[model samples]
Target chain A: MDSLDIVFTGFLISALRSATPLLLTLLGECLGQRTGVINLGAEGQMLVGAMAGYGATAAFGNPWVGLLAGAGAGVALSAVHALLVVGAQANQFASGLAVWMLGFGLSAYFGAALVGQQVTAFDSIDVGAAAQWPVIGSVIAGMTPTVLLALLLVPVIGLWFYRTRTGLRWRAVGESPAAARAAGVSPATVQIQAVLVGGLLSGLGGAALSVDYTRTWAEGMSAGRGLVAVGLVIVARWNPWWTLPAALLFGGAEALSLRLQTADTPISAQLLHILPYLVSLVVLTLTCLRRSDSGTPAGLKAVMDR
Target chain B: MRDLMLSGPGRVVGTTLAVLMLTGAFFLAIGRDPVELMGLIVRSAAGDGYAITESLVRATPILLCALATALPARLGLITVGAEGQLYFGALLGTGFVLANLGATSAAPYMAMIVVAMLAGAAWALLPAVLRSHLGVNETISTLLVNYVAALLVTWVVYGPWKSAANLGWPATADFPEAFKPSTFFDSRVHSGLWIAIGLAVLLHWTFVRTRWGLTLDVLRSNPRAGIAAGLNWRRNVLLTMALGGMLAGLAGILETASIQGRLQANLSAGAGLSGFLVAWLARNHCLRIIPMSLLVGALLASGDGLQMFANVPSSIALVVQGLLFVAVLLVGGYANRLQVRRG
Candidate 1:
């Protein structure tokens, strides 16, 4: 391949890899918001997941176990959120922030020991026949289990949201808890379940970051990607399928930033680093302007309306 | 016991005790003597003059940031944009200092502070406008803007404003001595502490003893009636957000001028978020925020001492801080339930 082709392929591959964590997080936030629970603590959940995943991988010598641990850690954090926001009727935003701080602190504390330790991260799977295909071959060949799983989940979740009875119940609860309760649908149970599942997915995203993407542990390694995912959910207009492109857009910006950093260019790397967040803000504003509160969950409206 | 626990003072004591117990349990789980660590933390945070000064220094930004959060919160707005405002403030203040590098007078210092506050207010107004005009969620918009603001600072420090004297270090030129905020008692604790405390007092008085306080309550509790009463909702939102942003921006600039001596990346050290927590802990009470900010500041300041004296990571401060918030929530929620039951 030519140098230009090589750079282009590298960018594409990195973008896909970067999108994995964001897509997982976006999907999870979408689930939670759809249940009328807006979690501002995804960052915290992701951090704990990243730490737990790395720690478990180091201890068990298995990345899969690490991923599970990450998910568990996320679920544990989200449980606190659910208990406070749902059970105690606490402010969702406050509870979420507390969760984020907890996750951040807990991860930094626990992951301190695991730092500088090496783990055998998840290896990309071989696509035997697909490896020979042109253009898409290289990208397809670089797919890890987590990446494929995340991509597959987009469609699966989309289907579940549109087709399933449970999904319908969740949408109903999100729209109006009182109405749902009158319909004999327990909004509390569904909302709690949605929160836990959201945590699980967020944790999985963090795990993917540590085990599959970076293949290493670092303090606050998830950075603001969890927060970025929160914004992307709005960009996606709370739709499961839309998260795919939304996540990819962010991931592409991230990949392009990294690429530009290495290239001979006058544009500052720090300026490029601002691309993902700035783009998200602009897109989110535009989306909200075009369709004001059209797709917002009614239950969430009550919380934010204040 | 139940009645006492449901009371205001009882809830405060209960939450404090709960947080302490949880922290002890955490230390025990890590195979350390909780008592010794706890004692050490207290001493390190406020044992002596130096420690007290350090705690105060840390508290300054947090106090300002809390005021920032609390201001908008009065109007029932949950804004987590203090961090961004702080950065934007420091960026603008630093930009002013950098531009007037040849000005050998104290006049630029005042101008720099104003510029920074305006910059912060400007940054915060974006979300407020978006929320009021486009019906977007202020919380999410503010949160997103924060990252952008931080990156903006990073871009400047690493690019346009990078000091030639620093030799590749990603920081702007250090402030001239005239630009430095006056410190107290030959320590790092600057005049910013007094400014923060004064602002808190002023705000508390305004919130409790003024017509504006009643205005905010009416707007928050009954927006339709408030609108009918000739109160402008959008204008109030904009004013509160801007004022809050100004406080956070002041924090950013002061920290930059006093502690950092130059604008650099990660300057606020999570002061904005810490302030938000303190505000919540104080239940958005301006006066209450003072003591809460000090408490949190002491806890954070002790982290370094813990890392030094014990083999514990400094992040334990964060863990403890988080636990404190959760404990407060649990206690506060329980109290609310009890009040409801009584009613």
Candidate 2:
């Protein structure tokens, strides 16, 4: 293969790798929105989760244990979010912002020791001899376990939203809580569950970064991926099914930018680095142009109103 | 009916105790001495004139940044983008000073401040426009613009504006001492603290005593009624956000001129978030912002002192702030619930 082909192959692999965490976060936020609460705490949750996953993996010698620990940490943090947002009906934005700081502080304080520690990243799922298949194998190549799980969730969540009774209740609660309450479904309970689950997946997203992707702990290893994932969820139109492609688009943009950075180019490095965020803004602007909100949860929209 | 509720001081004390206890538990879990940490926080924050002065320096920017959100907050727009606004302000302020490097001090100083405020306000208005006109969420728009501002700063420092003398660190050339803000007695704490104080007082009066302020409160709580009553909701949105951004701009100028002395990475250093937290803790009462900013500033100083003295992660302070914020909200919520029950 020529250099171009080599670069193309590398881009595809990197894009898939980058997409894992974003996909997890987008799905998490989607669930939270569907339950009438939009948790802006994903950024902080991801940070604490990253540290928890990395620290646990280092101590326990099991990546799965680390992943679970990360999810548990996220859930614990989100419990605070649930109380402030759902129970008290505090300003969701302020409450979420506070939680974000809390989680970040927790990570920095707890993971001060974990910084720079490395762990063996979880290996991709093993395929039989068919891995030797030329073109197809390259496309379906090595991916962490979390990536596989995220892909599986696409179908599972889509089915759950459409087919299950619980899913219908979630939509109802999200659309009109008073109506759902009249039907004997507690919107509060559904919101709490969804927020916790959102935290759980966000934690997994953090794990996908520290345990399976970066394989090393750092102060802010999750960076702004958590926040970006939340925005992409908007572009995804609050559909869990759409999050997969939206996340891939982000990850792909990220991968392409990194590749461009290494090439001999005239663009400033900072300008190129900003390409991903600019893409998010431009895409979001375009989405808004098409529709104020493609399909917002009315329950979630009500919380935003003054 | 009003007297049936918990008094304001009672709620404050209750929230304070809860936060302290929760933070103590966290410190203990992390293998630190909670008692020592508590004492250390107080000592480092206000144990001496030097420390008190440092806290004031930090509070200057914190107060200004808080206004960036609190002003818009009264209008019921979530403009947490103050952090980015600060950067835009600093970037412009830095550019102004550098471009007019040879001009006599008076006009340049005035120019830099004005330019910084305008730049910050302009950055803030981006999200307001997006939100009011397009129905996009201002929170997300403001949030994303923040990253864009940071990136612009980074590009400038590393590219066209790099200081050749800084030994490869990505920073702009230092400002001449004449360009720096005038300082008060015995310390680095500059005149910016007065601006913070003066602005706080003015904003409080505007929000509480003026018709415009009442209309803004009305606009926030009931937009339809405000619009129906001939209050300009859209204009209110722009004005409040612009005022907020202008305050945050002053913070950026103070940061670049008084503290950093040159543009560099980490200039804002979470000032925007800290400001937002201070605003929330103050409950958006403009007059209360001063004390809240001071409290947070002291905590920041104490955190740094803890890092130096006990080898503790400074972020422990953030954990405390977060606890305090949540605890305060919870107490307020509980008090509201109690009143509802009684009714």
lDDT of 2 by residue, B1-343 (tens): 3453377777777778878888889878877789988999898889899889988888888989998889988988877888889999999999998887776658788889999999999988888887877767888778788888988898899998899999999999998777788888869899999988999999999999999999999998889998999999888878888878888887987899888899887688788988998888887898889999999988887888878887878887878877877887777777777777777
- Where model 2 places Cα greater than 4 Å from the true spot, the runs are A1-9, A129-136, A292-294, B1-6, B340-343
Backbone clashes (count) for model 1: 0
lDDT of 1 by residue, B1-343 (tens): 8889887799889998989898899889989899998998999899999889999999999999999999999999999999999999999999898888788777888999999999999999999999988878888889888989999999999889999999899999998888899988799999999999999999999999999899998998898999999999999999999999999999999999889999999998889999999999998999999999999999999999889888789999999999888788877877777788888
Kindly report which residue stretches of model 1 are placed more than 4 angstroms away from their true locations once superposed. Answer: A1-11, A133-135, B1-5, B341-343
Clashes by residue pair, model 2? none
Q: For candidate 2, report its TM-score.
A: 0.95
What shift in Å separates residue B44 of candidate 2 from its native position after superposition?
Answer: 0.9
The numbered model that scores best in lDDT is 1
RMSD of 2: 2.1
Interface RMSD of each: 1.2, 1.6
Give the DockQ (C-alpha) for candidate 2: 0.65
Task: Name the weakest run of 10 consecutive residues (lDDT summed) in model 2 chain B.
Answer: B1-10
